[model samples]
Target chain A: MEQEMVLKNENSLSSSLKQMLLKLTPSIKKDGIIKSLKNTGITLLSILMFIGLWQMGSKALYNKEADYRIEKALTERGEEAAAAERACIESGDSSCQPNTLPSPSQVWASLQSLIADHNLIGAKKNAFAKKMAATNEKMIAEGKDPIVYTGRASFVDIVLTSIKTVFAGFLLAMFIAVPIGIIIGLSPSLRSAFNWFIQIFKPVSPVVWYLLVFMIVKTLYIGDSSDNAFVISFISVGLCAMWATLVNTAMGVASVDKDYINVAKVLKLGTFQKVFKVILPSSLPLIFTGLRITLSVAWMVLIAIELLAQSQGLGLFVWEEFQNGANDSNSKIIVAMFVIGIIGFLLDRLMLAVQNMVSFNKNEMA
Target chain B: MAYLELNNIYKTYGEGENSTEVLSNINLTMEEGEFVAIVGFTGSGKTTLVNLINGLLQPTSGEVLFKGVPVTDTSHERGVIFQNYSLLPWLTVGQNIYMAVKEAFPKESKKVLMERVKEYVGMVNLSPAINKRPKELSGGMRQRVAVARALAMNPEMIIMDEPLGALDALTRGNLQDEILNIWSQDKRTALLITNDVDEGIYMADRIIPLKPGPNATLGPEFKINIERPRDKTAMNDNPEYKKTRNAIIEYLMDIGDERKTVSDVEYKLPELTPKSFVA
Candidate 1:
């Protein structure tokens, strides 16, 4: 009787399941979901472990520094002073802080503090715009320049500026590098002539490029354009980062398949058609590889250029926070570092996606 | 004047003591609508000879003339099917042929151009793979795309340089029949370079052997008197087919033996007297 009852239940389930799943293959969706869930769990666990290790390290350093302070007090001012120092440190006195690596909690606090500061600045800017609106309108009607609100950029604003500068620099590099590369690649004499030039300039430092750009930009702008810093930073970034793209594009174009060239010749293709159709298509994978390198280079050089050129960006934020030396300055810097790393990783993934779409030489990513 | 001619062509590489004469005094001529095959060993300078005719490589000391004009550079009039498929990996089968068709007849509308591509691709029985990239297709399929591309150009002279050399035997035989059918339709002047004796005999009006190089030159031409639209199975039993096949194979064997004899010098073998253990 129990067996019959179980059989009846099984028959009902199978009748419904058979309608839903017509194919013979097993449940792939369920497997995929389980696999992804496992991966996510592992990722979460590893991150938790990292945070625990960091907390331990931060506490150890703090204690060591605190102990050193207490020992110094004992030697210099005897037992009473040592006792007082210990009391001050234990009471969370800012003056007696044991400056060391900030714990994860402190970094999280800094992130929240940054968000609040951004909100405060955002309100101030809105108020400023409200105050300036009438005057700016009047000035515009009178054929005079509108009054602009100049304020300190928030952390998010600064990051966006860095992103914008990197993109501009990347565009500059691609434009300047690709055309010149194609020309040099097509002609053997030009390649030979430029080889030494490329080798010499390829490894130039960002700081040197920044100064060179500053020298030209300073002369180019007669007055306070306020765009000078941005122009200088982006130009320096382009000059510093373009070498990889230039070299790779040249190599890619040069190493286009000889068979393709023979095909182009047999087809009786014109110069323009041949280059665009045959040469470019065949060498695309290498060119994209070069461009990927160039983008990463542009991003790397942008930070240094921004710092040197006094451009408003993440670099400036980090530098200012470092110089500020407040209680939470180090924590803020740590937050910025993580943000930079994550953004850089995302940028690389973006380029990889683009490369796979365009290259046609498909295999899994290296 | 002959439709196409090679006037005592020679191709040499390097200079002074290092110089090697590749093709020595290669002379040939073909009238309109003739099929010719140059059969040779694998490493014999057959490709060099094809390149010379197609104007991809200049003959070191002579000339290739077509229709009483010096062949200086590649032209649409002379379409070549390279040994390697040479299909652009980025383009689909249809696009590969379309690119050639567009170049050959630039004034045609897009509609007409596409029709021609579809027609040729279908002719090769690759209609199913029209949208597939060269990388996606098998070796024979890619080669068929190449054949389609060359045929679509509608060249006066078709130069096939061992185009089916990389395929399996069945595929090779199938492509051979397809090419022969195409040739019979227009009787387009064609030059086939192959190492396969049977391929040469089956395809060409005249079978010429390229003597293995150092100085690979064309040997005496054998005019294949076997008629076409020739049936493969029936021809095997025919006396004329037997006679021609034997004669060509014998000539090829004799040349092979001669080359071997020239290269094979007898060396005195050292007498292997086992060294005495006392020594």
Candidate 2:
């Protein structure tokens, strides 16, 4: 009986120990889970802090009573103008007051309505026209004529148009920029001959390019068509954005290691194969960086061309908002600007992710 | 007749007002299936001579004949192992070796080619890390991979430019033995560029010192009549090894003294300052 009891005790103790070890293994992994949670909390706190700071700064800038009062007056004037137009007469000094600026709350409401309308009807040519017609009809029902209060295009409509043109221009710019840059960077004689041109054009300002493109397009195309204006604006934006891409490509190709070139030669690799497989892949980091910069410059120049030419795009939307002088239009413009910045940021981040994927040694670049 | 010869070569950089001669009246010959080591100090044009022989660079005057034909450009027959372990970082160990193997034998089927690669990779004892990229391997492993790569091509001649110079002593010793075993099996014409006198004595049938430059060229060659398959532990104890090492050391020391004498001339010059003129 004593031997049996002793054997049973030892067996139970061994089984319990195994169970304990199995439990502890998971507990060690659980520590990592807690550590990651703590990291996440810290990141969230930092983001909240940044947003709080931005809000506080914006409020402080508009804190003065004169500025605050002017914003209030503008809101009141905008409403009065709408009501007076309903009565078929100008609202007089109250409608077109120069000193007044729309309040933030009024602008926010305007932006909300614009977003709701866009989401409901979409930003297509036919849908936008239909939405406008419905809006004009609603004004008539309220006993107001939808006059040429803002002769410029609708804020949302102009933004949509600008986005389309800029993307087309950006694509065109990429095609020309990357190839030219590679050629210039790789060939010594080409680099020497074209380097001066690159330097002269890099800092020449998008507005100047926009103007030159506009004049050239206008003079060249005598076609009596509305489509011609859109084509002209796109060409202008593309030319302005092309420089950043071209220079970057050239630099990337030029910076590939001499050692790699020799390796290619030793392998007896053909010229085209060497370029694509060895040289191009090695210079991916610089090339991707150039692409990111070119994308942002293209977006920026696209808006500038639209604003200057009063052509379609986000630039035109911002310009239209300023002319409209209504609280809603001003707020809509602010929202459009936010959307532009956010999109550009996302595009750059995507390019960076792509760069990380294709690189040979990630740690060296990081 | 020598399999490859550098007949009284001259190489100079720049011209006219800024001319600088790098090598002058250089003459050397490499025999077939011979392991020759050239020991030199830094900037001794050892690498330049190797480059000229490999046809990566051409000499200004003399001819570099390989199998009695002048080497003008890069060729598969004259395989060069660079100092930098110039393996493509993006390519895996097996792939890098396979690239050269494929170029050396393009008509061979993939199966046979890969089998050859596996065999060579196994020889270097790197069959485990065959799929790993260059960056993933340690420095010693990378050098071994380079050795395996060169051997896989089965070139007529293999030129190594300080192949083990960057390695740790233990790794260097291991690779040196491995290289010797491979060289003995085929007796390929091998030229090693090294500054290690002891290493040269152990490996080569003969040692040649590339004298230091402004105008550097090969000095007198020393024959090591030591028996095949040298023992490193016993090398220091051997009288012939000691004598050969001391003779080469003495020659290097003399060259060093000559360089010092050339540099010290300005310091020992008669005073030519304004005070001297006044006196």
Against the reference, the lDDT scores of all candidates come to 0.90, 0.80
A1-366 in candidate 1: lDDT tens per residue?
Answer: 533343354555577565345233235534655799999999999999999999999999999999999999999999999999999999998998898899999999999999999999999989999999999999999999997768889988998999999988988998999899888988999999999999998877889889888998899897875568899888888888888888888898999988899999999889999999998887778778888998898888787788888899988888988999999999999999998888888888999999999987797446
Candidate 2 lDDT tens digits, A211-310: 7877887777767555566787787777877876787778889988887887777767778878876778777777777766777777777777778877
DockQ of each model against the real complex? 0.74, 0.48
Weakest ten-residue segment in model 1 chain B by summed lDDT: B232-241
Alpha carbon deviation, residue B183, candidate 2 (Å): 1.6
The top-ranked prediction according to lDDT is: 1
lDDT of 2: 0.80
Q: Write the per-residue lDDT of candidate 1 for residues B209-264, one digit (tens) a residue.
A: 99988899999999988888888788889888788889888998999999999999
Q: Point out where model 1 deviates above 4 Å.
A: A1-45, A130-143, B265-279
In CAPRI terms, model 2 is classed as acceptable
lDDT by residue (tens digit), candidate 2, B175-269:
99999999999899999999889889989999999889979988999999899889999888999999999999999999999988987855567
